[model samples]
Target: MANLLIIDTATESCSVALKYDDQVYTRSEIAPRMHGELVLPMVEAVLAEAGIKLTQLDAIAYGQGPGAFTGIRICISVVQGLAFGADLPVIGISSLQALAQGLYQDKKQARVLAAIDARMGEVYWGQYEVDANGLMKLLDQERVCSPEFVTISDPDTSIVYSAVGTGWSTYAKVLSETLNVPTVIHDKPLYPFAEYMIPMAEYLYISGESYAAELAVPVYLRDDVAKKAKDL
Candidate 1:
């Protein structure tokens, strides 16, 4: 297995994971507004436990957006600095996909409706299903909209879905009324975890999808909305 390090501060959770010697070491905490303080320490702790420096890793990965703007910025900037300093390539994993991957990791759920509370009376949403390779594959474009506007692009009645992330906690009734599909809602794992991102990151790295540190970017689904609001 290739050595890799992953970081995520996309939601209230701040997490870091390092893969070394085919073993994974992780640190995570659900501490909102404290991500800036917690993330680097967590990274240090995991690298220490893994007994390797950042330069030893094949690539670095980070949760790339559809989350709190500041949190996403913090994650991307940190990863950029670390990867640039180490001369390592970086991979950007979707925060929504990470949430879906978390559910798959814990419950082996094949179909997941992942959403993150985007605030401003909206949610960042995506539909994901496990592929033949056992990786969560996004079925449609991820979007940010009000709870009532959330949808499943193509519904499969034979398949039951799993719901995850903070959005469900805040808008379950609305989403339930909107989706019109059988879904088991999960109360835990309300935020993306770096540990779950490792598989996707490793796959991306092996596929030659990794990019330079300067290319690391955050994906805030509501950029247009934010710009409009700023103009107002």
Candidate 2:
């Protein structure tokens, strides 16, 4: 396994994880609007626990999001700064995918409907199924849409999908009605975590997908909505 450092502040969660010498160290908390204050210290804590320096990492990975605009920005900017200082390559993992991965880790759920309450009556959503390698793979493009319009492109009635994220909690009735399929709702992991991001980041790093610090960027599914919020 590569020595990797992972960070996420893409939802209400602020998390950091460091993988070194086959052991993982992590720190996480659901502290909304406090990510900026919490993330760096969390990073320092994890690195200290792992007894490693930033420059010792093979690469740094961050939650590149379809989440709260401010949270996503905080994650990306912090990652860029850290990667630049360490002269390390960076990887961007989707927050939705991380949610699905967390469900898989927690329950071994292979199929997941990951959603984040995007506010404005919509959700940031994606469908994921575990690959043979056990990493969650996106079934279609991640999207920002109303609860009523959300769907499963290839619905299998025989399969019991797992539902996760704050979106399900916020619009449970509407989303459950719209999906119209059997689902087991996971209430514990409503937000993404950096520890779950390790496998995906390791996969990407091995695949030669890591990039320079300057190339790291956030993925806001609703660009127009983000812009409007920024303007206001």
Candidate 3:
């Protein structure tokens, strides 16, 4: 059993989870602009509940995102510090893939369309197809684009796609009409969660995908736009 600590602050949500001895403990809250303060506490809480020090963890995992610019920075920076201080390797999970994994975990759906509202009339979106082992695999490249411009690559018309994340909630009808495929949407898994990152991290760690603390990075798709909006 691997001891894993994971955190996600890529959206409006701030969450932390510890995977210990085949079990998981988590703390999460939807707190926009408060991730810097809230994330560390959540991390401490999960670690305490798991009864392990930071150094005891196998590796640190984080939601490196195509989500909020500030929130993604906070997550990667905090995780970088903790991993560096503890000499732990790090694994970065995609926010879009995590959103798809969240649905796969909760809905048992194999085909998913994950999208985050990218603002400025666009979204950061990707298509995910789960394998028999219940792991989400990205079907195509993830990109930031308008709802009309977003397209699912080689989508299974025979299967119903599960539409997930904040983008769907914000543009339900338009997305449905735009995708030109049948979709089942649930607005609850609108943000990436640390809990979902654990499974992906498990696979990556076993595949020797962890990296040094300094290598941990964020994946903000609309950094320029997000920064300009922040300045305003």
Q: Which one is best on TM-score?
A: 2
Which pairs clash in model 1?
Answer: none
- Residues 56-137 of candidate 2 have per-residue lDDT tens digits of 8899999999898889889989999999899999999999999999999998999999999999999999999999999999
Candidate 3 wrong stretches, greater than 4 Å: 223-232
At residue 97, candidate 2 shows an lDDT of 96
Clashing pairs in 2: none
- Prediction-by-prediction clash tally: 0, 0, 0
Model 2 weakest 10-residue run by lDDT: 223-232
**What is each predicted model's overall lDDT from 0 to 1?**
0.91, 0.92, 0.88
CA deviation > 4 Å runs, candidate 1: 225-232
Ranking by TM-score: 2, 1, 3
Q: Per-residue lDDT tens digits of candidate 3, residues 68-87?
A: 88888888889999998999
Q: Report the error of model 3 at residue 179, Å.
A: 1.4
Per-residue accuracy of model 1 over 143-222 as CA lDDT, tens digit each? 99999999897887777889999999999999999988988999877889999998899898888999999988788888
